[model samples]
Target: MLPFVEYAAKGEHTASIIWLHGLGDSGEGFLPIAQELKLPDDLGVRFIFPHAPEQAVTINGGMVMRAWYDIKSLDLDNRADESGVKASAKAVEALIQAELDKGIAGERIILAGFSQGGVIALHLAPRLAFKVGGVMALSTYMCAPQKLVDEAVQPDLNIFMAHGSHDPVVSMSAGQLARDTLQHQGYQVSWQDYPMEHQVCYEELVAIREWLMATLS
Candidate 1:
């Protein structure tokens, strides 16, 4: 199993947020954001940051690195790494179950991530047997759109999606597509766009903080 780092609020906040990072990043990369966001202090939420297993990313031409999945090619039309997606999905599911065992109910847990990690969160959030509090996908998209409709276990899950208008890595269209697909499937989605590119901005953080408070309150 991949290693994971954890951050817990000082208070007894039952709610939890699983923070997943993008490719090439370790779990530590996003743990500090929990502090910067003042999430624990504000909402009494715990955080879980899980590291993706280190492997070669095909999209990067088999470069040995940490990736949630293989990006088979630069050709945007090429196939995705299905095997990596499955493995990461199972890992994420396991993490959710572990949190449950620690007394966090499924509905009090939020699946959140950025980029590749966001892809995983969106992929797994709807499939969990129990409904989650919400999902936050930042600059990401659905990995397997076709499988979602059939596999999703919860159609009413709340989702917050944000994308940079000038994003050069993951196109804004990807985020739009995700929003469309989820709404078509009957999910409640809150979508936002920022004026930046491929990264989170201060305004985006403020919006996320407000969403978290509203959803978890």
Candidate 2:
């Protein structure tokens, strides 16, 4: 199993959110965010944060880092490491299965990630055997979007995407392209933008909390 830290539900555990962090970041990176969110105790949501394995990131001059996949170039098309993505996707899929083993239905589970992690979440959605509750892709762009053309629209598979307008790391243009591409493919996406760089802001968290409440509750 991919190493993870869990925040047990404050109330009864009825739902689960398996979240992944961005490249060079471990599951510990976003653990604080769960405490900050206003997900009501009565909602009974268990949050799981999984750490990505350390690997050599090509774009980082091959320095080993905690990443979902290796980034080849700044260009969107050739950037993502597809093999690494599939490996992480399989790991994430195992996480969903762990929740299932614990009796939580697939529709009550959400897959979320940041940046490179978000790319994995989006990639895993169409490949899932069961439809999940929702997907939250923050500051990330879709990899290999053409592969989603023949993807079926799951009943409640909503996508919540947020990006920074001034993000120098992953350009906002990439985010917009993902939104347009997913919309054209008939995915329900709630796209939001903030006036910041490649990081999350307080306001963005509020929007995320609201979107989560609406989509998962």
Candidate 3:
């Protein structure tokens, strides 16, 4: 299992939300967001923030950082290395299985990510053997999109995608392309765009809270 920081549910622990952070960030980085969410106590939602292993990202002068996959180039089509994505997906699957072993149904678990982390969430959920509650992909794009049709297992996935209109790291168009790809593949995608940058804003959090309630209820 990946090393993770967990915010345990306050009540019966009926559901789980495994959230992934962006490149160069540790699990601790997003712990505050979970707390800020202030999800209702009755929901029993546990948040798991996992740390990506340290790696030398090629685009960043090969300097080692926490990355889900290597960004070999800025080109969206070739950014994420296939092997790295699969390896991280396998690791994330183990985390999901751990939740399952603890008696939480797969459908009660929501997979979410930001930026590079979103890349993993988007890539792994459809390929999973079982269905998850939903996927929250923020400011991210698809990886190996051309192969998604042949490799996908869950065709009825619930996907919520949000991107900043002014995002420079991951352009809004890149995010749109992802939404378009998923929609073309017949997956249900809810798209939202904010007038902000690469980071999340207060408005987005409010929307996320509402979505979480709807998804986990």
Off by over 4 Å in 2: 151-156
Flag the better candidate by lDDT, 1 or 2. Answer: 2
CA lDDT of each prediction against the hidden true structure: 0.85, 0.89, 0.94
Q: Best by TM-score, which number?
A: 3
Instruction: For candidate 2, write residues 117-207 as lDDT tens digits.
Output: 8999999986687999899999999888887876545534689999999999999999888888788877889999999999999999999
Please report, as a residue range, the 10-residue window in candidate 1 with the lowest summed lDDT: 73-82
TM-score, model 2 to reference: 0.96
lDDT by residue (72-148, candidate 3, tens digit) is 89988898998999999999999999999999999999999999889999999999999999999999998988899
Q: What is the lDDT of residue 122 in candidate 1?
A: 88
Which residue pairs show backbone clashes in model 3? Answer: none
Lowest summed lDDT window (length 10), candidate 2: 148-157
Model 3 ranges off by over 4 Å: none
- The number of the candidate with the highest lDDT is 3
Q: Lowest summed lDDT over 10 consecutive residues: which window, candidate 3?
A: 70-79
